[model samples]
Target: MRVFLGITGASGAPYAARLLAALVDAGCEVGVSASAAGYEVLATELYGDASLPHDEVRDRLVGGLDGVTVYAGNDYSAPYASGSAKVDGYVVCPCSMATLGTLASGAMDNLVHRAASVALKEGRKLVLMPRETPLSAIHLEGMLRLRQAGAVILFLAPGFYHEPKTIDDLVDFVVARALDQLGLDQTLVRRWGQ
Candidate 1:
């Protein structure tokens, strides 16, 4: 399956990174985009360098993962911009509120929003993993609107039923749930019965 993974400025950079790695390991064709703030957050949270070069930044963020294509946020001509591109699904692993609002309002100011809009218009699976806390009414409304528009709003609320013991486990829980939404089987998290 083809997947579009969008990373935003949210604090959960590890989730996006893990999700991309999992998708690649699962043998899916993945297209990735990191928002401007996403780069800053990633630099601060993942990499120690706060002023890394763009290519070096991407390399550090992606860590030599295969089967994934990275796109610029401003590049509207990317394959994901066209409905005929035939992407099976799209996931904003750490979707920011700004991006969510843009998607809800039908604003294609960037490639991330545009790809999501394309997914919605084409009736493809568009999963949003919003990583906000103490959500305001506006955020809830934006999520509601996206849901009504047929986009799956997957909040970054990881379940503790599996008793996660580490940060990686927590990240896996959410990524596993995302993979489930995409209809791909995974054991990233322990199931209730298992």
Candidate 2:
């Protein structure tokens, strides 16, 4: 699978990081782009240093990972920006409500939004994993609009029915579903009714 993973400004940096690793482990060709705030989130949540340089953060996030390419937030010329590119799927992990509104309103300000727009227009799989609480009416409506547009709004909430005992387990629960949505096999979590 060829996948585009967009990291946005949200609270679930762990989810985004783990999902990126899982994508590469699944043998998918991955393209990554992080918004300015996304980089901060990664640095703060994952590294405990919000002031870490972008290059260092990038190195930490995708260092030594093969089959992955990192693009700038403003890199509109990326292959994922166009539907003509053979992208199998697109994911906006830790998708901020701002990004949700932009995508729902058919607005594209960066490569992330453009890639998602192309996914929607081309009828390809697009998964948006947002992490937020107490959503207002605007957020709900935007999510509804995107759902109706055929995008999967997979929240970063994990179920405990599988008896999760650690934070990584909880994170894997969500990432496992995301991998499934992208039509990739994942053994991170045991399947229900197994």
Candidate 3:
């Protein structure tokens, strides 16, 4: 599978990082992009350093991954920016309201928004993992619009029925669910009936 992963300026950096690794582990061709704030969050959450350079933060996030391509947020010429690029799915992990609103408005301000727009227009799978709490009406409405447009609004809330024993387990639960939505089989978390 060819998937585009966008990390936005949200709180769930762990989820985004885990999802990227899982996607590569599943043998999928992954394309990743992170916004400025997304890089900062990754640096702080994953490396315990918010002062790291943006390139260094991105390098840490994608350094040892194979079959993964990293794109700049403003790279509109990326293959994922076009429906003809044969992208099977697009996911915005830790999707922020700012990014969501841009997508909802049908504006292609960056590669993330452009890729998502292409996914939606092409009838491909587009999953958004938003991590906000206490969503305002505007946020809900944007999500509703995206849902109505055939995008999957998978919030970053993980189910605890699996008796998660660690923070990584909790993150895996959500990543597993996102992979499921992409029609990718993964054993990151135990199945409900298994």
Candidate 4:
């Protein structure tokens, strides 16, 4: 399967990273894109460097995955831009409010949003892992709009039923749920009956 993974400026960078790793490990071809704010979030929250280069950012974001291709968020000419690209699914892990708003409104200003829009138009799976908390009415409305438009709005709300002992475990829970939605095998987090 070919999956397009988009990372935005939300707080759950780890979730995006782990999801990419899991997708590659599952033998799926992956295409990745990180938004401008996504780079800011990675530098501020994950790497502690405000001026990290794009290649360094990509290296840090996708440290463990192999055979995965990374694309610029602004590259609208990428293969995933067209519905004929034959991608099985698209995921916006750590989706931000701005990105969500764009997707909800059918705005394709960038490759990430365009790929997501293409997925929706093509009737393929499109999952969004929004990580914001204390959501306002506007955020909820945006999410509703996207959901009604056939997008799976997977908020990065982790469950404690698995007895997570660290931040990584919590992030994995969300990523695992995303993988489950994609019909991929994952051990990133435990299932309910396990």
User: Which one is best on TM-score?
Assistant: 2
Q: For every model shown, what is its TM-score relative to the native structure?
A: 0.96, 0.99, 0.97, 0.95
- Candidate 1 residues lying further than 4 Å off, grouped into runs, are none
Clashes of 4: 0
What's the true lDDT of residue 177 in model 2? 96
Model 3 lDDT on a 0 to 1 scale? 0.91
Q: Write the residue-wise lDDT of candidate 1 on 151-187 in tens digits.
A: 9988888888888899888889999989999998898
Q: lDDT of candidate 2? A: 0.95
**Candidate 4 at residue 155, lDDT?**
89
Q: What lDDT tens digits, residue by residue, belong to model 4 across residues 5-51?
A: 98889888778777888898899999998888888887777788868
Clashing pairs in 3: none
| Root-mean-square deviation per candidate | 1.1, 0.6, 0.9, 1.3
- Number of the top lDDT candidate: 2
Q: Write the per-residue lDDT of candidate 3 for residues 1-194, one digit (tens) a residue.
A: 89999988889999998999999999999999888888888888889998899888878888899999899988888898888788889999989999999999999777888889999999899999997889999999999999999999999899999999999999999999999999999899999999
Please give, for residues 59-167, the per-residue lDDT of candidate 2 as tens digits.
9999989999999999988999888889999999999998999999999998899999999999999999987899999999999999999999999999999899999
**Candidate rank order under TM-score:** 2, 3, 1, 4
Question: lDDT per prediction?
Answer: 0.88, 0.95, 0.91, 0.87
